[model samples]
Every structure is written in C-alpha cells, then in structure tokens.
Target: MFAFFTRSIAAKLLVVTGVAIGLVLFLSNLVLISQTRDRVHALTMEQADAEAKSIAREVAGDIGELASAARTMAGVIGRGHEGQSFDRQGITNILKANLEQNPFAFGSWMAEEPGAIDGRKDDVKGQADLGANDDGIFTPYWSKDRNGAIQFSTFGAKYDAEWYALAAKSGKGAITAPYLAEGTDVPTTMSSIAYPVFSGGKMIGVSGVDISLLSLSDKLKALKPFETGRVLLVAQGQQWLVAPTDELLMKPYEEAGADALKTALSSGTGNLVPNLADANGEGFDRLLFPFAVPGVNTTWAVIIDIPHAAINAPVEAQTLMMIVGGLIVLGAVMMALFLAVRSIAQRPLHGLVGDVERMTKGDYASDVSNQDRQDEIGLVAKALDGFRHKLAESNMLAAEADAQRKAAEGERRRNEEERNQSASVQQHVVTALGSGLAQLSQGNLTYRIADEFPGE
Candidate 1:
C-alpha cells in the first residue's frame, strides 16, 4: 500500500483527500460534542434548581399549616367562648379537637400565666411532690401517644422558655427549629409554634402546637435529583433538617463541611457548591436552593447533592461513541474515494503508459487508444497517437531513400560492365589488326577468321 501510494497520482490524490476529509470530520465532531455537553450541563442545572424550589415550597407550606393552627387556637382562648370565661374543660375540648383536626401536628398546649386562666394558681400547688416542676402555672398539654391516643399533662412554668417568651414579647406566632422528640413510639423530628392570646387588649397566655417534621424527611428521601442525586433540608442556623444519612439529622451543617455552604446562607439565595466534603470527608457537588417556613423568621434551603461522576456520565459516554463513530465514518469514506480515484484515473493512465511503451518499440501499426475522450488521459493518448504518425512518416521516408540509392548503384554497375566490355573488344581488335598487318606479311587470312569474336 505504501509503495502504490508513493508511485501513483490516483493513490496520492486519495490520500490527500482522505486527510482533508478526516480533518473536517474531527473538527465538526469536536464542536458538536462540546456544545452538546454544555447544553446538557446547563439544562441539568436549571432543572435541579427548579426541583429544589418545588420541594422548598412544599416544606414551607407544611410548616405554615402548623403555625396557622396554633394562632387560631390562641385566638379562641383570648375571645373566651362568646365572652364567657375559658375554663379548664373548655381548654381540654379545644386542645383535643386541635390535635384531632390537624393530624400533621404532634401535640397542642396552652401555657397560662400564674393565676391567668380562671384565676387558678393553687391547683398546681400540691404538684411539687411529684417529679414535675412546681411553678404555679396552669399549662394544659394535649398530645397523641404512640397509638394516636390523646393524652393530657401539665407543662408547669415553661412560660419563660424561648418559644413562649418570643410569642409573649412579639405578640405573634412563629415556628421553632426541628428537634428529635423522644419518649414516643412515633419518634421523629418535631417543631413547635407559639402564639400569644390577648383578651380585652391585654396579654393573657400563650397557645402553641407541635408538628412532626418526619414528613419533610420522607418527602426529601422520596425525591430524587437527576435520578441518582440526593436531597437535604438545612435550616437557617445551619442545622440539618433532612439528610441522606440519619446521623446528620438535626445536626449542625458544620458536620457536612463548613466549606460546602460557606456564604450560601448569607447570600440567602440559590447557589452551587463544588467538591463539598462531608463528615466522612467524602466529596460531592451540591446545589443550594434557599427557602423558608412561613413566620419562622429564618432561611432554609433544599440541597441537592449530585456526585461528580453522575454529572459527567452522560457526556463521557457520548464522547466515546462519537470518537468511535467518527473513525468508522472516516474509514468508510476514504475507502470509497480510493476505489473511485483508481477507477476514474489510474486505470486509464496505465493504458496510456502502455501505448507510449509500444510506440518506443516502433510498433505504430496499431492505433493509439483513448484519443477521443476528453480528459488528461485522452490528451496524453492524442499526443501519443500524433507521435506514432510522425515516427511512421520518418521511417517511410528513410526506406524510400535507401531503395532509390540501391537502384542507382545497380544501374551504374550495369553501365560500367557494358563499357568495359566494349573497350576490351576494341583493344583486342587493334592488337589483332597490328598482328594481322604483321602476319599479312605472313598469314593474315587465318588470323582474321580465328579472331572473329562477339555478337552484341
């Protein structure tokens, strides 16, 4: 193959064309694949952002339900049942109904000021004998047990706690961060909301509700980003509300790499993190989607964790396929071109070379072939045919001149022979006459008869 390509114009042209075609194919595939990867990456990022937003909205809506329920119950207490005093039985009925109506809620309670509800303070005075706190506050707590049974207990003087104090100070309801609520069969993450009750434009007590955030974790777990990516929910204080691993649940974000979310929370918007390391020091890329619970006064975000390999898997496969397919296509095209150039050009040129060789050997009787066609081969054939004719003419003239010279030499030889014969005869006659003259004096008549020589 190398020798043939080196020797033939057709093979050389095919090689050149093949190289040009290969270059074009390589460049085009490179550009197309690069653009495809970029578009795919952009599309995945965009869809990831939108998906995170949707999950954020769902969680926010769920938290809002808990806050609204707490505020509604507090409003009822402050109004006091159509301007009647809200006694202990009234509080019991309200708390039970609140728990029954809001199945998402884990518990509901009212924390009253000392002597605040029905002026009851001494009702808990004897409670110090028990393990419960003895602060004289009539705090009625209604909660569901593991079997969903409604149970009652007193909250004691937890009125000064942050949840209660924030409500009492701000005169509004707000949701707390998630915590693991123990001592239940339905143990899961729980949060609370506290709302202040006001009667006659004066502060009275605080009513609150607790909602389990297990549903949020369940929703996040069910949600798959990019088919194989993970999802998590991080609260405002860098707390992990939802995590892929249960060990990360209700823990601070530092466990999941401080470098991961560096300024994302401060930015308070959606962003991306590259090569984030977890507590195990395993790395992943994450999309941070910011959200919030209503009236929570803190930003929360849905984090979509995608593996580095996951993001590049599709493009890498495509690149491999394109490289293989491009090589195959280039080979096929080059083979076709090789066949075409050999047929259209090399074969005819081979015949012309033969004609030229035959002409060199003085074989001009046979006509040169391919002179009528219109191409380089035809042009060469025409020139070869013309040379054959000119060569034939020169040979013919040479042959005629040689024949004429031979004829002239033959005629001259015949004339010279005739002249020599006559001269010899004349000399002999003269010698005979001299001899006869001498012999006539002796025997002239016998000599003349003997010497009678030739007939012309």
Candidate 2:
C-alpha cells in the first residue's frame, strides 16, 4: 500500500490534502475548546455570585421581620402607650396581636427590671401568665402555635441566658447567633432579635422575637441551578447553618475545610470561587459565593457544587460537532480532488505510457489523438509522434539504398567475368598463329597447301 501510494499521483494528492485538513482542524479545535471553557467558567462564576446575593436578600428578609417586630414591641412597651401613660394590659394585648399577625415570627416577649413599671416583683418565676400573677419584674411572653392559637407566658426570672443578657448589657437592639430553638414542637435551628426596653431615661428590659432557620434551609435546598448543584449556607465561624445533610448541618465549619467557601466569606458580597472540588473528594466542580445580608452584622456564605461533567457538557458537544463537520468537509474536498486528478492528470499520463509502449515495438502507424489537446500532454504526444514518423521514413530510405547497392555489385561482377573470357580467347588465337609460323619456318609448305589454302 505504501509503495502504491508513493508511485500513484492520485493517492499522494489525497494524502496531502487529508494531512493539511487534519492539521488545520487540530489547531482550530484547540483554540475553540480553550475559549469555550473559559467563557463557560466565567459565566458560571457570575451565576454563582448572583445566586449568593439573592439568598442573602432572602435571609435578610427573614431576620429583618424579627428585628422589626422586636423594635416595634420595644418602642410600645418603653413609652407605655406612646409615652402617654403606663398600661401593662395594652402592652400584653399588642404582643398577642403581633404574634398572631406575623407568620415569620412564632413568639414575642417583654421582660423588664423589677419594679421598673408597676411596682411588680420578679418573685413569681416560671409562671404561665405574667399579667395575672404578682411579680416584682414585668415579664410577659406571647407565642402563636401552628394552629394560630396565641398563649401568654413568662420568661422565668433567671435572665442569665445570652439572648436576655446581651439585650440587657447592650443598650441597643441585637440579633443572636444561630442556635437550636429549644421547647419547639418540631426540632429546628433558630435565631432571635432582642431590643432593649427603656422609659424615663432608664433601661427597662428587653423585647424579643423568634425566627426559624428551617424555612431558609428549605429555600436553599429547593434551588435547581444545575443537575448536581448543591446549595448550603455557611457562617463566618465555618459552621453549617443550613446544609443538605443532617450530619454536616450545625457542624463546625472546619469539618468541611472548604477553602473556597472560606475565601468567599472573608471577601464579602459579590465574591466568587470557581472550580473547587467537593469536600468529600467526590471530584465534582464546586463554586463558592458569599454575601453580607442587609441589616445583619455578619458575613454569610453560600456554596454551590456543580458537577464537572455538567460544566463541560456544552464544550464537549461543540467539539464533537466541529470534528464531525471538519471530517465532512475534508471528505468532500478529497473526493472532488480525486475526480479532478483522474481527469486532468492520471488518464492523460496513462495514454502517454501506452503511446510510448507502442512506439518501442516499431508500430508507428496509429495517429496520436492527444497531439491536438492544447495542453502539456498534447505537446509531449506531438513530439513523440514526430520522432516515430521521422525514424520510420529514415528506415524505409535506408532499405531502398541497400537494395540498389547489391544490384550494382552483382552487375559489376558479371561484367568482370566476361572480360576475362574475352581476354583468354584472344590469347589462344595469338598462340595458335605463332605455332603456325614456326611450322612454316620448319618447311611445312606441304601441310599448308593441303589445308584448303588460305582464301583460295
């Protein structure tokens, strides 16, 4: 096969064209794949950042509701009905109505210092009804259930918890860190907004509202950006406030050791980290994006783990399409080239070979058809045919000259023989005459007289 191709012009043409096409396609494919991969990666990062910002807004909405409710309650209780007069029942009624009306918050509370408002004492701790009981401190907890039922209770006199202490210690309102909400019907993590109550230029107590993390987690889980994308929330401390798996949830952030997530959280809003591997070593591409929630003091992170396969799927498809398209074009070009070579080069060369072979056998009688073709082949054919005609005419002339020379040589040989015979005859006659003269001299007169004497 190799020898045939080297010896054949058609095959060589095809091979050269194929190689040239292959080289061009290879370089083009590399450039296309590189550009496509980079473009897709950049777009993916932008999408991750957008998603992160959107989640921040949603979480802010949840936390903002609780903070707003707490502030409203705190302002009402601090001034005692718009700073007109102290009304304990009015404050209790306002708390009850807020918990019933707001779906985001499940509870509301008002805890004041002992004897700060109505000579109430903090002695009746752990009581269910603060309005009816006699207490030195004014403490009333109002909560709504899933059935929309509102109940009155008290925040026991302990007040040692971080939520209460932080509000008492800080004169302004504050939001607590995420923690598991205790005494709830369903187990879930939650946070609270605590606003300090004040009246007459003195600190009264703290008003609080509870917000759940379950709703936020549900929203995160429901996001479907990609087939294998994962949505989870991370705190600044690297804790998993909301996660897909129960084991990972509420666990220390170090357990995941997501460097990308950590970087995004530290960089604040609009930061993105792309093409990281899963913490579990699953070999999937992950993107980490973090943003700060408005009205919240903490920077939060949202991570999206997108599969490498998903990210490269479009690139692979485009590559395959280009390869197929290149092959198709190459095939078409090669086929057209083969046909042109056969007509323009191969067939003419074959005819020239036949003409030369016939000339070698001394058969020059046939006409050279390609002589008038008006191409290189025609020139070659005309030259070869001219040489053949010249050689044939010279051979005929040489043959005729050889025949004439042989005939002349035979005639000349015959003439020479006749001359020799004539000479011999003349010599014999002369010798006879000499013998007669000798006889006469010897007195042979009688013999001459008897021979019918000369001319009698």
Among these predictions, the greatest TM-score belongs to 1
- Give the worst 10-residue stretch by lDDT in candidate 1: 124-133
Cα lDDT for residue 260, candidate 2: 58
On a 0 to 100 scale, what is the lDDT of residue 134 in model 2? 44
Residue-wise lDDT of candidate 1 within 90-126, one digit each (tens)? 8767877988898778888877766766665655553
What TM-scores do the predictions have?
0.79, 0.78
Count of steric clashes across candidates, in order: 1, 8
Report lDDT (CA) for all predictions.
0.76, 0.71
Backbone clashes (count) for model 1: 1
User: TM-score for model 2?
Assistant: 0.78
Give the residue spans of candidate 2 off by over 4 A: 81-89, 114-119, 131-160, 255-263, 266-275, 279-282, 365-456
Candidate 2 residue-wise lDDT, 353-440, digit = tens:
8977887887778866588788888898898889889878887898899999999999999999988977877776666777778888
